[model samples]
Target: AQTVTQSQPEMSVQEAETVTLSCTYDTSESDYYLFWYKQPPSRQMILVIRQEAYKQQNATENRFSVNFQKAAKSFSLKISDSQLGDAAMYFCAYTDSGGYQKVTFGIGTKLQVIP
Candidate 1:
Protein backbone atom coordinates (compact mmCIF):
# COMPACT_ATOMS: atom_id res chain seq x y z
CA ALA A 1 0.00 0.00 0.00
CA GLN A 2 1.15 3.53 -0.77
CA THR A 3 0.02 6.88 0.59
CA VAL A 4 1.05 10.45 -0.25
CA THR A 5 0.89 13.32 2.20
CA GLN A 6 1.11 17.07 1.63
CA SER A 7 1.50 18.73 5.01
CA GLN A 8 0.61 22.21 3.83
CA PRO A 9 -3.00 22.63 2.77
CA GLU A 10 -2.29 26.02 1.26
CA MET A 11 0.74 28.07 0.18
CA SER A 12 1.46 31.51 -1.20
CA VAL A 13 4.32 32.91 -3.30
CA GLN A 14 5.15 36.20 -4.91
CA GLU A 15 5.49 36.58 -8.65
CA ALA A 16 8.99 35.84 -10.02
CA GLU A 17 9.85 34.42 -6.61
CA THR A 18 10.25 30.80 -5.60
CA VAL A 19 8.21 28.37 -3.53
CA THR A 20 8.75 24.86 -2.40
CA LEU A 21 5.81 22.55 -1.74
CA SER A 22 6.45 19.65 0.57
CA CYS A 23 5.31 16.08 -0.04
CA THR A 24 5.97 12.77 1.63
CA TYR A 25 4.98 9.21 0.82
CA ASP A 26 5.05 5.79 2.42
CA THR A 27 5.25 2.63 0.34
CA SER A 28 6.23 -0.99 0.80
CA GLU A 29 7.23 -1.44 -2.83
CA SER A 30 10.90 -1.15 -3.67
CA ASP A 31 10.29 0.23 -7.10
CA TYR A 32 7.94 3.13 -7.60
CA TYR A 33 7.53 6.53 -9.20
CA LEU A 34 6.87 9.85 -7.52
CA PHE A 35 5.25 12.73 -9.30
CA TRP A 36 4.03 16.30 -8.87
CA TYR A 37 0.95 17.36 -10.77
CA LYS A 38 -0.68 20.74 -11.20
CA GLN A 39 -4.40 21.24 -11.63
CA PRO A 40 -5.54 24.71 -12.51
CA PRO A 41 -9.01 26.21 -12.47
CA SER A 42 -9.82 24.25 -15.63
CA ARG A 43 -9.11 21.06 -13.69
CA GLN A 44 -6.47 19.51 -15.91
CA MET A 45 -3.80 17.38 -14.34
CA ILE A 46 -0.44 18.46 -15.73
CA LEU A 47 2.70 16.56 -14.92
CA VAL A 48 5.28 18.83 -13.35
CA ILE A 49 8.05 16.34 -12.78
CA ARG A 50 8.70 12.68 -11.95
CA GLN A 51 11.29 10.73 -9.97
CA GLU A 52 12.11 7.05 -10.03
CA ALA A 53 12.94 5.28 -6.81
CA TYR A 54 16.03 3.69 -8.34
CA LYS A 55 17.47 6.93 -9.66
CA GLN A 56 20.13 8.71 -7.70
CA GLN A 57 19.50 12.03 -9.39
CA ASN A 58 16.45 14.16 -8.78
CA ALA A 59 14.11 15.16 -11.58
CA THR A 60 13.70 18.65 -12.91
CA GLU A 61 11.74 20.29 -15.69
CA ASN A 62 12.62 23.88 -16.47
CA ARG A 63 11.85 26.00 -13.41
CA PHE A 64 10.16 23.07 -11.69
CA SER A 65 12.36 20.72 -9.75
CA VAL A 66 11.99 18.00 -7.12
CA ASN A 67 13.96 17.23 -4.03
CA PHE A 68 13.66 13.46 -3.85
CA GLN A 69 14.92 11.80 -0.72
CA LYS A 70 14.27 8.08 -0.92
CA ALA A 71 15.66 7.45 2.55
CA ALA A 72 13.42 10.05 4.12
CA LYS A 73 10.48 9.19 1.88
CA SER A 74 10.18 12.82 0.94
CA PHE A 75 9.63 14.39 -2.48
CA SER A 76 9.19 18.14 -2.44
CA LEU A 77 8.61 20.42 -5.41
CA LYS A 78 10.48 23.68 -5.94
CA ILE A 79 9.04 26.17 -8.31
CA SER A 80 11.47 28.87 -9.42
CA ASP A 81 10.34 32.17 -10.89
CA SER A 82 6.79 31.66 -9.87
CA GLN A 83 4.15 33.16 -12.08
CA LEU A 84 0.39 33.67 -12.01
CA GLY A 85 0.01 30.53 -14.11
CA ASP A 86 1.77 28.59 -11.40
CA ALA A 87 -1.11 29.19 -8.98
CA ALA A 88 -3.07 26.00 -8.77
CA MET A 89 -3.88 22.89 -6.79
CA TYR A 90 -0.71 20.83 -6.65
CA PHE A 91 -1.01 17.11 -6.06
CA CYS A 92 1.72 14.70 -5.10
CA ALA A 93 1.20 11.22 -6.53
CA TYR A 94 2.76 7.77 -6.42
CA THR A 95 2.58 4.54 -8.41
CA ASP A 96 4.42 1.27 -8.25
CA SER A 97 6.40 0.01 -11.21
CA GLY A 98 4.92 -2.38 -13.76
CA GLY A 99 1.47 -3.50 -14.90
CA TYR A 100 -1.70 -1.56 -14.30
CA GLN A 101 -0.68 0.24 -11.18
CA LYS A 102 -3.10 2.51 -9.40
CA VAL A 103 -1.82 6.04 -8.71
CA THR A 104 -2.31 7.29 -5.19
CA PHE A 105 -2.66 11.05 -4.81
CA GLY A 106 -2.37 13.41 -1.88
CA ILE A 107 -5.19 15.71 -0.76
CA GLY A 108 -3.32 18.53 -2.56
CA THR A 109 -1.98 21.96 -1.66
CA LYS A 110 -3.45 25.09 -3.12
CA LEU A 111 -0.73 27.53 -4.29
CA GLN A 112 -1.53 31.20 -4.53
CA VAL A 113 0.74 33.56 -6.44
CA ILE A 114 0.62 37.09 -5.11
CA PRO A 115 1.32 39.87 -7.54
Candidate 2:
Protein backbone atom coordinates (compact mmCIF):
# COMPACT_ATOMS: atom_id res chain seq x y z
CA ALA A 1 0.00 0.00 0.00
CA GLN A 2 1.14 3.52 -0.81
CA THR A 3 1.16 5.98 2.07
CA VAL A 4 2.01 9.67 2.18
CA THR A 5 3.79 11.14 5.17
CA GLN A 6 3.87 14.76 6.22
CA SER A 7 6.17 15.23 9.18
CA GLN A 8 5.19 18.82 9.71
CA PRO A 9 1.85 19.16 11.41
CA GLU A 10 1.86 22.95 11.17
CA MET A 11 3.90 25.74 9.56
CA SER A 12 3.82 29.54 9.52
CA VAL A 13 5.35 32.13 7.24
CA GLN A 14 5.39 35.87 6.70
CA GLU A 15 2.97 37.34 4.21
CA ALA A 16 5.64 38.02 1.58
CA GLU A 17 8.12 35.25 2.30
CA THR A 18 8.56 31.75 0.99
CA VAL A 19 7.91 28.45 2.71
CA THR A 20 8.54 24.85 1.86
CA LEU A 21 6.47 21.94 3.18
CA SER A 22 8.02 18.51 3.40
CA CYS A 23 6.31 15.29 2.29
CA THR A 24 7.46 11.73 1.85
CA TYR A 25 5.76 8.57 0.63
CA ASP A 26 6.23 4.82 0.42
CA THR A 27 5.18 3.00 -2.72
CA SER A 28 6.24 -0.22 -4.33
CA GLU A 29 4.87 0.58 -7.75
CA SER A 30 7.31 1.95 -10.29
CA ASP A 31 4.73 4.10 -12.02
CA TYR A 32 2.43 6.38 -10.10
CA TYR A 33 1.44 10.00 -9.56
CA LEU A 34 1.88 12.48 -6.74
CA PHE A 35 -0.19 15.55 -6.00
CA TRP A 36 -0.49 18.43 -3.63
CA TYR A 37 -3.93 19.71 -2.81
CA LYS A 38 -4.84 22.79 -0.85
CA GLN A 39 -8.03 23.07 1.16
CA PRO A 40 -8.88 26.55 2.22
CA PRO A 41 -11.40 27.61 4.81
CA SER A 42 -14.08 27.08 2.17
CA ARG A 43 -13.31 23.36 2.37
CA GLN A 44 -12.70 22.95 -1.33
CA MET A 45 -9.86 20.71 -2.46
CA ILE A 46 -7.82 22.58 -5.05
CA LEU A 47 -5.04 20.91 -7.02
CA VAL A 48 -1.77 22.70 -6.50
CA ILE A 49 0.61 20.66 -8.63
CA ARG A 50 1.26 17.16 -9.89
CA GLN A 51 4.27 15.00 -10.76
CA GLU A 52 4.56 11.73 -12.59
CA ALA A 53 6.87 9.09 -11.21
CA TYR A 54 8.37 8.40 -14.63
CA LYS A 55 9.14 12.04 -15.23
CA GLN A 56 12.45 13.35 -14.00
CA GLN A 57 11.54 17.01 -14.11
CA ASN A 58 9.68 18.66 -11.28
CA ALA A 59 6.42 20.53 -11.75
CA THR A 60 5.74 24.19 -11.07
CA GLU A 61 2.74 26.49 -11.19
CA ASN A 62 2.99 30.22 -10.62
CA ARG A 63 4.14 30.52 -7.02
CA PHE A 64 4.09 26.79 -6.36
CA SER A 65 6.70 24.16 -7.18
CA VAL A 66 7.54 20.61 -6.23
CA ASN A 67 10.72 18.75 -5.41
CA PHE A 68 10.10 15.26 -6.67
CA GLN A 69 12.63 12.62 -5.76
CA LYS A 70 11.47 9.40 -7.29
CA ALA A 71 14.36 7.31 -5.97
CA ALA A 72 13.66 8.41 -2.41
CA LYS A 73 9.92 8.44 -2.88
CA SER A 74 9.84 11.99 -1.64
CA PHE A 75 7.70 14.86 -2.89
CA SER A 76 7.60 18.28 -1.29
CA LEU A 77 5.80 21.53 -2.08
CA LYS A 78 7.31 25.00 -2.09
CA ILE A 79 5.29 28.19 -1.97
CA SER A 80 7.04 31.38 -3.02
CA ASP A 81 5.92 34.93 -2.31
CA SER A 82 3.35 33.63 0.13
CA GLN A 83 0.39 35.82 0.77
CA LEU A 84 -2.33 36.10 3.37
CA GLY A 85 -4.70 34.33 1.05
CA ASP A 86 -2.37 31.34 0.93
CA ALA A 87 -3.30 30.28 4.43
CA ALA A 88 -4.85 26.86 4.28
CA MET A 89 -4.44 23.14 4.95
CA TYR A 90 -2.13 21.47 2.46
CA PHE A 91 -2.39 17.76 1.77
CA CYS A 92 -0.06 15.41 -0.06
CA ALA A 93 -1.73 12.70 -2.11
CA TYR A 94 -0.65 9.69 -4.14
CA THR A 95 -2.28 7.53 -6.81
CA ASP A 96 -1.06 4.53 -8.71
CA SER A 97 -1.80 3.35 -12.26
CA GLY A 98 -4.49 0.78 -11.67
CA GLY A 99 -8.16 0.21 -12.10
CA TYR A 100 -10.42 2.31 -9.93
CA GLN A 101 -7.48 4.22 -8.58
CA LYS A 102 -7.96 5.91 -5.23
CA VAL A 103 -6.00 8.82 -3.83
CA THR A 104 -4.29 8.45 -0.48
CA PHE A 105 -3.76 11.67 1.44
CA GLY A 106 -1.49 12.55 4.33
CA ILE A 107 -2.67 13.92 7.63
CA GLY A 108 -2.02 17.40 6.20
CA THR A 109 0.03 20.45 7.12
CA LYS A 110 -1.75 23.55 8.32
CA LEU A 111 -0.15 26.70 6.93
CA GLN A 112 -0.64 29.99 8.73
CA VAL A 113 0.32 33.19 6.94
CA ILE A 114 1.30 35.82 9.43
CA PRO A 115 0.55 39.36 8.49
C-alpha RMSD by candidate, in order: 0.7, 0.7
Q: Give the per-residue lDDT digits (tens) of candidate 1, residues 6-27.
A: 9999999999999999999998
Model 1: C-alpha RMSD to truth?
Answer: 0.7
lDDT scores of the candidates, listed in order: 0.95, 0.95
- Pairs of residues at least 3 apart in sequence or in different chains that clash in candidate 1: none
- Clash count (model 1, backbone only): 0
Lowest summed lDDT across 10 adjacent residues in model 2 is found at 93-102
Which pairs in model 2 have colliding backbones?
A: none
Q: What local lDDT does model 2 show for residue 91?
A: 100
Candidate 2 lDDT, 37-115, residue by residue in tens: 9999999999999998999999999999999998888899999999999999999999998858799999999999999
How good is model 2 by TM-score? 0.97
